[model samples]
Target: AVESEAEKRDRATREIGKRVMEGWRILDKKCDDCEVPMLTQGKDDDKGECVLCGKGQKKVLTEEERDRAVSEIGRRMLDGWKLEDEDCCEVCDLRMCSKGDKKECVACGPVLPPVNVNLELPPNFDFSDPKALEALLLQVQKKTSTANQVPPTPALSEQKEVDKVNISAPNTPNRYGSNSNNYPNTPSSMQMQYPNTPSAVPVTNEEMSMIGAEQKIREGWTMMSRAYCDCGGPMMRAPNSREAMCVNVHCVNSCY
Candidate 1:
């Protein structure tokens, strides 16, 4: 069905109003270049020119528009903050930062310069002043006196008492009795009790010489017993005498 002329006129008027609103809307790209608001008009031959820059540009915006654009960029940066390459460096074995120009480990990021976090010095640490030195000395003396004055604890005192008791206690005879002999100098008879006699007994020259000979023979036997074959078997004594021999001939020859 054909529309009436009055309806068509009203539609054209509405279209004109929409076009006017669109003309007022700022364009971001053109506004970035211009420091001020721009007047825009649609023409058949060319798009438009920035009133501030006079650069024939299609997009233009005001200061508020520029701020919005910067904010949007910042938001995008925050949202997409990530390492550019998932690929780790072969040498450093760390993820690279996503920033294109980054030269160091991007994911782990470059190590910041070490900050000196040492506490600031007090304004009054002068050592040259005799009064200051005297005050410090007094503090040190007080601390030393306090440490020295800390009495021996109960446990320490008890331990000292125990030690004193042990020192004062009389000596008791061994289980084998005073005259039970072991080495050459030990007494031979447990019952030959003397009231105040010393525990040790003197040995005769002949007895001492015999004991020395026995000890030498024992040591020699021990040395010969320790000799072993390549197969790790012990040396054995030969049939009739004191001489020892490794059973394996090869071991005996090598060992001897």
Candidate 2:
């Protein structure tokens, strides 16, 4: 299909493939003077010398190599280096000189003279002022005193009272108890006692009730047995209970 003039112009301006362009290029010929490959003007102009540097054929870099070279050059430029041109010695191709300064080349003059030096001094620190030294010592002594001084201990109670806790049952398993022999009983004036031992301290009614409750719990009570419903209704035993559930009718089979 024939493209329109504008489309044709756009397509013509677009980049051509390297392979196609290379294939279209006429083969280059080696220049006789430089021995470098020179682009042939035509098939008839195959044998010739280089146009620019007539000594030898210059090797043309591939695209990838050229890109790498450009990247390296850019990296060097970023790191404060650049390619610069300078005039070299036309005769020897290198510029160098000797003696004290730049005038004749190294071939004509003696080298620079040797150089050296020597000196010595004693090292010492000053702290001889009695007033200043005394002040510094006083400051250090004050800091040491402040650090070493112990704070006064605070009183824990107005007066010490012996702990009145009394345990009578040697057979009773309590996690808090640590006795290996028959229990000791100290008759305290404040404690109320049971008739079993007049020598033992008395247990009040509240203590007796607490001990009884603890015993009851140790015998059989469990968290599931104490289950309460979301509505706060007390739990009742379910037959064949696979999981703990509430007793409320409103919460059928719901977990407590």
Best by TM-score: 1
Per-residue alpha-carbon lDDT of candidate 1 for residues 176-210, written as tens digits (9 for 90 to 100): 25423332322343212222334254222212222
lDDT, residue 111, candidate 2: 19
Winner by lDDT: 1
lDDT of 1: 0.32
For all predicted structures, in order, the TM-scores are 0.17, 0.15
The TM-score that candidate 1 achieves is 0.17
Model 2: per-residue lDDT, tens digit, 1-256? 8676566333322211111122211124554653334432111132233433433333344554433333332222233333222522222222222223422211111112211111121233123344543454354434433443444222111113323323234454232333322222211321222224333334332233223322322334222333444444333333454554442222324221
Off by over 4 Å in 2: 1-53, 85-256
Q: Model 2, 187: alpha-carbon shift in Å?
A: 95
